[model samples]
Target: MSVKRPNPAQWLWYAVGGKLPDRYREWVLHDATAPTWLVRHVIRRLVFMAPILAALYLVLAVMMNFDLTIVLVGLGLGVYAGMYYSLIFSTHSVDSRVTRHGYPDQYASQVRKALKQAERDRYNATWRNGGATSR
Candidate 1:
């Protein structure tokens, strides 16, 4: 026996309700590759992150005004923020690569290749100029 597929609109509604639309999976997967869909995905992820960050900041600030417990909570939040930012923003970082492109591994490889080519060009230019650099 064969299963009937659900309508695309119904699938979207189900998806919004946190349910997987097995019937429309192929169509959804195909649409995910479109530019508009990709942009929407990025915006959705960022929108989700912003609220959590704001809440964390608010909780930390409120805690800092109280007693020792609050102070400790605030300190923990500060450490978390510092580590998170450092890991996300470090040179040639995975998070940075992902944000610039879409996927981490693919973007990392591309960045590595670009850096290697740039270094090779600089080396060749300096060697041709007898170790003198060009601006």
Candidate 2:
């Protein structure tokens, strides 16, 4: 089934662990060959992450009596640390998600790789097409 194209708002939802509301099983989650799949996934994850980190930083700042400089430093350190750790265990996260969506666990890597290639191709295609990225 074809999914209705998601609006920017829905994409934000997708970032936050919500399943793609449309064509999730057939396209976004399963096909892995869609041009924007890899980039789309990464963007979604990052979108999901921003608010959480902001909340963390806010709480820390409040506890520290609103020291903006210290909060910034801590936020920077937290971002770097979070990125480092997420990379180390990214596969487990992907595999678990894939499994949750009913795909075989072992297919996780393949799916991701395909999605990456598709995104690359799409990006190149956009450059080739007069710098206009079509949808």
Candidate 3:
């Protein structure tokens, strides 16, 4: 089934770590526990950063009359710091989001763990056992 997703504004609010309405609850659960959830989460974070970074650049360059080089350097440092901190709390943040959506705590983790078990089993079969297996 095609998943019901939020509108652009709702998505942006979600990206900004704001809570979305109940109508988009299923979409939020799927987003927090999809097969590529981690990558998707990282992408959402980058999406959240882009606009903020642009605004920061604008404020520094225009409001403060700073040089382009200084603004760029500051933006670069900010991006690095933002990503480092965001990633450090990636799982915690995602889990918290799931709970906020009315799911039990660590629900995303449990779902992802079950989803990954098949892959782990295949890896163990292919390499851990032997390169060649009886069919």
Candidate 4:
């Protein structure tokens, strides 16, 4: 059986989905010292906000007291701003907290291990197929 090479689009799709390839998934998910409470806190905040924001948007849209186009634009901007803050500020806050206690370095080391394993696998496959030649 031939090994199926990943296409460029597959790599892009993986990036868009915020995932690494299968070989790295295990290592990435392994958290040696994850602060469970912090993770839960962040998750709860996101879960709580999603429905509240949706309900507010729906109520505003239904009221229709303001101009529909303006309301829609404002709603769009609000959602965009919220997501931007979450992605930028919230993530930095979490990372900083994690790093201050050294969780980030552990995570980075795990990721590097996974990447190295992937590279070794690729090299071995190529060598087995006679792609590597001795000088």
Candidate 5:
């Protein structure tokens, strides 16, 4: 048995939390300790789920004849629920993974703090540079 590897375009989908490879997960948990990392983590989950939400809307409203307004409301609620779950679960997963890799549990909080500080510094730098920041 063999697992098919995702091509370049599909890599983004995996990065969004579709069973991230252990190597990548380790790298993220260990090396990427910046506030933007958390932001990107949340973005990845949201982006990964967008297509699922769109398909749900199409199925409910177009194929199943549900009202469009109801479908929209349903998707909105679903997204909110997903956001709540993803943030908590994703963080916990990273923390556990780091601990499994031999780091102490407290290291997880340290990583988060470093990420927050990095984000704050970036914001301040952008502000100092005339409020123009490139990606």
Candidate 6:
């Protein structure tokens, strides 16, 4: 399938966990399976958080009269806790996202394993097949 980049509106929808149209299937697959997928996912998640965080900052620091520094630190801690769990469930998250876009279950993981097969084979040959470990 050919890769077609989603427009900004589609990307914003995607960032907020909305599914893209069928035309973006290949892009979704590539986005979830590419080498930089982890970083991309994190960035996407963070983008989704931006507006919420801004609203939170306004509520805590402005309306509630909390100290700006304290509010910022509190928000930072909240983000840290969220990111911890997000990373832990990242694989499942990606798989779900890809599936929501109409791909098969675990398609990203399968693609990644396939993409690395040659490199994995080389590593096994070097380490397990007496290339250097046997010495």
- Model 2 RMSD in Å is 7.9
User: Regarding lDDT, does 3 or 5 come out ahead?
Assistant: 3
**3 or 6, greater by lDDT:** 6
Q: Tell me the whole-model lDDT of each prediction, alpha carbons only.
A: 0.49, 0.64, 0.87, 0.51, 0.68, 0.89
What TM-score goes with each of the models?
0.31, 0.58, 0.81, 0.38, 0.57, 0.86
Q: Which stretches of candidate 1 lie over 4 Å from their true place?
A: 1-50, 57-65, 68-105, 127-135
Candidate 6: regions farther than 4 A off: 122-135
Scanning candidate 5 in windows of ten residues, the lowest lDDT window is 26-35
TM-score of 2: 0.58
The digit string of per-residue lDDT tens for model 3 on 39-58 reads 87888888989998989977
Instruction: Rank by TM-score, highest first.
Output: 6, 3, 2, 5, 4, 1
Candidate 6 residue lDDT tens string, 1-135: 568999999899998899999999889999998999999888988988889899999999999999999999989988898788888888999999999988889999999888889778988898878586533
Better of 4 and 5 by lDDT: 5
**Model 2 misplaced regions, further than 4 Å:** 1-5, 30-42, 60-64, 111-135
Better of 1 and 6 by lDDT: 6
Question: Which one wins on lDDT?
Answer: 6
What order do you get sorting by lDDT, best first?
Answer: 6, 3, 5, 2, 4, 1
lDDT of 4 at 64: 50
lDDT of 1 by residue, 19-50 (tens): 34455444433333333543544443444355
* Tens-digit lDDT track of model 2 for 79-120: 778667766666666566556656777466776687678888
Best by TM-score: 6
Better of 2 and 6 by lDDT: 6
What value does the lDDT take at residue 64 in candidate 6? 95
Q: Candidate 5: where are CA atoms >4 Å away?
A: 1-10, 16-32, 96-108, 114-135
Cα lDDT of model 5 by residue, 1-135, tens digit: 333444556557455544445545445454335446567667767787888998998899999999889899989999899988878786665565456546678577787787778888898877966587668
Considering summed lDDT, which 10 consecutive residues are worst modelled in model 3?
126-135
| lDDT score, candidate 6 | 0.89
